[model samples]
Target chain A: MSAVERIPILKIGDVLLASIQVDLQDRDVLALQEDLAEKITATGAHGVVLDISAVDIVDSFIGRMFATIAATSRLFDAHTVVVGMRPAVAITLVELGLTLGEVRTALDLEKGLAILAELGERAPR
Target chain B: MTAAREDIPIAADEDVVRVRQIVRSFAQRAKLSLVDQTKLVTATSELARNTLTYGGGGAAVVELLGEGRRQGVRASFQDSGPGIPDTALALTDGWTSGRGMGLGLSGARRLVDEFDLDTEVGRGTTVTVVKWSR
Candidate 1:
């Protein structure tokens, strides 16, 4: 039986960080999308930060998957932020008309964390 | 040998890189703006990958239309795999027969100026896309 590869999980203060590895092969994309959503739900953190710095391209499918994860994370009462999108990938996403307006994005992990902190403070009691 | 241009078959996933290279070459030859080039290339990649995955391999034929006037590029992707049953549902954003979000065909259509699809059950499917110079 083939062993399942575990996605890397990192704890950054109160935030649960999950980094997506760079391969981005066609077959792995769907699974990666589902896994990211599950991780966010299970962690029950204040916010979920996804680092896709390793990914060089954001194909249509993957781009949609990111939107799905963001929507799903919100259902679990967690905010989702995607960081480290490559310039080419960003351009491709825009060209493909995938306006990830719902998914908060930042230039780097630090910016993502800062946004998360701001969102955290603004949450309703 | 000088052969008719229409007689040539589109090239499929000979290699993953082939799709991108062809896109870049065609974009330059067509004199498409950078934004339009990226849009067309991304759409081309999605369609090419579909040909490889569901079609069990196929070819994409690209041609630059209108020499001096009305210039544009037309790309046709033909595959010998089972054709889609419901064209309308297939065009829906979230519909997919496989793991994909079903965005390939729909998104490809959205990226270009003109899109056409023809298919027959058990026969095959052919998608043609055109991007005009703006």
Candidate 2:
């Protein structure tokens, strides 16, 4: 069996970036959620950008995981923005009636960081 | 193009990921477009999840095929658990019997060129889908 591949969450300034490039397993999903939550507390980040451009597919569980990450980050006073979703993934999400509730999305990482920056400015310090 | 067939076990979420990988490998071998590959892989993942979660475990068979000048891949899911009580309702958007968002059947059908479902209460369920290369 191949070794486990973990999604690395890198911090740039006050924003955390997590790029998903693998077809994640169940444990991997749980690991990401746990790791992101821990990183938020450890880094004191004010924003997070998850780049899923390499993620070609997402089911309800995966979609729910994304929403959970965003919701969890909000608890730490950090904003989360998802970026780089392919067109086909969008279509599947819509067809499944998954809105990714309250999780912001952008076309790419640059725009995602920009949105987070904008939100950070609007947030009451 | 009916060249190869593979049966993958689906007893857990890990198996679901495995199914997607199998789909991806076949899609690449068939020279499907990236978009098409993503669609089929997504569809197969959903189906595999349904088999593992709702069906109490099952298997998916990936097959490569050819008709005239058309080439494609087909994934068929089979399970020995309780069958769906209402397949039509199950296929509806946002309708789920368990915890899912009900995208397994409907969304999968949309992503592929052909889809077929077979189930018998107290017997089992089977779902088949095909995506032709464009």
- For model 2, the DockQ equals 0.56
Worst 10 residues of 1 chain A by lDDT: A1-10
Tens-place lDDT digits, model 2, residues B36-56: 887888888888888988889
Worst 10 residues of 1 chain B by lDDT: B1-10
On TM-score, the candidate that comes out on top is 2
Question: Clashing residue pairs, candidate 1?
Answer: none
Cα interface RMSD of each candidate: 5.0, 2.6
Query: Residue A26's C-alpha lDDT in candidate 1?
Result: 47
In model 2, the fraction of reference contacts reproduced equals 0.58
Tens digits of per-residue lDDT for model 2, A69-99: 9899999999889999989788767755678
lDDT of each: 0.73, 0.87
lDDT of 1 by residue, A50-81 (tens): 89998655667667767877787788777889
